[model samples]
Target: MVSGGINEILRAVEFILSKLLSELQSEDENDVEPKTKVRLIVPNGSCGGIICKGCATIRSFIEKSQAGIKISPQDNNYYGLNDRLVTLTGTLDDNKCFNT
Candidate 1:
């Protein structure tokens, strides 16, 4: 009789755990954001790109903002002028924040 009671309790605990696990998984799936918005930061007439890759502020923003940033490949022409393509995983507001 005691063994039967222990087995019932164990099964109940397992059922409760499975329900909690599914709920937690659903919440995690909703928490992640997809990168859909794209913006191109054009270069200036002079040296450095609009978002200078070498700048400390830009690097810090990229690391924390969860946005994807790509600069034009360096070459003869792009070296003097660069274009920064920013892919925002969060929202359009992120670009304004980064620009400031």
Candidate 2:
């Protein structure tokens, strides 16, 4: 369960980094990095999710990343499941990530 959360976060980070790096290689580097988002279907209230320790861990990971990432619970639930949709939006600067 915990590994799944970690994998989700890793995928989001990879997607964002790849996008940022591609922008860096382009001719025009002035454009602001577009906001990136990752959605997940997590357990609902009946499963003690959306506020469980796993969710808290995800929040912590975002906070510690300091990459302008935000995670929030959406209003809608997953299709045909007792799961919820969670969105992880990122506003991290491309230069901050690729200017090394």
How does each model score on TM-score?
0.36, 0.40
- The global C-alpha lDDT for each of the candidates, from Candidate 1 onward, is 0.48, 0.54
Q: Return the number of clashes found in candidate 1.
A: 0
* Tens digits of lDDT, candidate 2, 1-99: 234586697677667667755765473556565555556566566334334575785555455554443334444655655566566566545434324
Please give, for residues 1-100, the per-residue lDDT of candidate 1 as tens digits. 1135866866664455456445655666664432244444544432253355567655756677655555544455545544444443443322334243
Residue pairs with backbone atoms closer than 3 Å in model 1 (clashes): none
Runs of candidate 1 exceeding 4 Å displacement: 1-32, 45-53, 74-100
Output the lDDT of residue 46, model 2.
32
Number of the predicted model whose TM-score against the real structure is largest? 2
Error of 1 at 22 (Å): 27
Candidate 2: segments with Cα more than 4 A from true spot: 1-28, 45-50, 53-58, 67-80, 92-100
Residue 28 C-alpha lDDT in model 2: 54
